[model samples]
Target: MDTVRETTSAIKLLEQENIPYTLHSYPTENGPVAAVDVAAYFGYAPERLFKTLVTSDHKGGYYVFCLPAEKRMDLKKAASVVGVKNLQMLKPEIFEELTGYTHGGCSPFGLRTKLPIYVDHSANNWDAIYVSGGKVGYLVEVQPKVLENLVDAQYAEFTK
Candidate 1:
């Protein structure tokens, strides 16, 4: 089994809580890589891999949403779930600035601050799911409940 000795804040917190998880590493590609691509690279179903998205309401409140790699977030549903009139995806620059992790590396686990997180209901069907490991080219496999508890996230139908 592959293990990472270096600790990211996300990994450290998981370890401290004794949550069971597995670390996965992949070679970095030359250009942008999508979550679906990562899933394919790891030989996992796209639905088992999730992408963490940061969004902001018109009032400037930040929220996080996790959905299957192959699905698109339903903006209207996402806004409704968060009780906002509207939501816009946070710009890459703003996301990195606020979360301290780049676009492809954002994990709900160890953000600079605690933001409300909403995971798509579909994830509940899986025993475990994969999410970014706070960096590009790395992923963490963890039980959905473990991830939900770690981030205080709620699950809802927020994907199209």
Candidate 2:
């Protein structure tokens, strides 16, 4: 483990709010990193690691969902929950502009856009889940409740 700590919007928020968390780090990679790979790097079960996904209605509306790394999103059903006919994964080209974080580094806490956040119900199955630390190669181990409260998020059965 590295003794040096890196700062990111998510980490800042955790510090400011006095939330308890364990920060984990890995070698920085040049391209997009997959959620499952991250979990493997930390030796955590895939179910206890989450990936933050941003979707758009192809209009101006956008939404966020956090789900287990090993699961797949049920796009059609997720759209139905938000009353949107459909939802498309957000483009990597503008991920940073929209969320203030890179593709694999998006954390629900520090998104630039004020979008609705939905956490998969499965997250409650773990005492703590690992999510991006607002940067690639970094992750934060935190209680699921901290995430919901931080983002005013809801729980949904949106994964298959």
Q: How many clashing residue pairs appear in each of the predictions shown?
A: 0, 0
Q: For residues 1-160, could you state the per-residue lDDT of candidate 2 as single tens digits?
A: 4589779998898988999998888887553378887777778899999899999896668899999999999999899988899999988887899899988789988778788999999889989998889998888999999978888989998898
Kindly list the per-residue Cα lDDT of model 1 for residues 1-160, writing each as its tens digit: 2554457777777888898989887877663399998899888999999999999988889999999999999999999998989999997778888887888888878888889999988888999999888888778999999767888999999898
* C-alpha-based local distance difference test score of model 1: 0.87
Q: What is the C-alpha RMSD of each candidate to the true structure, in Å?
A: 1.5, 1.7
Residue 98 of model 2, lDDT score: 88
Query: For every model shown, what is its TM-score relative to the native structure?
Result: 0.94, 0.93
Model 1 segments more than 4 A misplaced: 1-5
Q: Rate the local accuracy (lDDT) of all candidates.
A: 0.87, 0.87
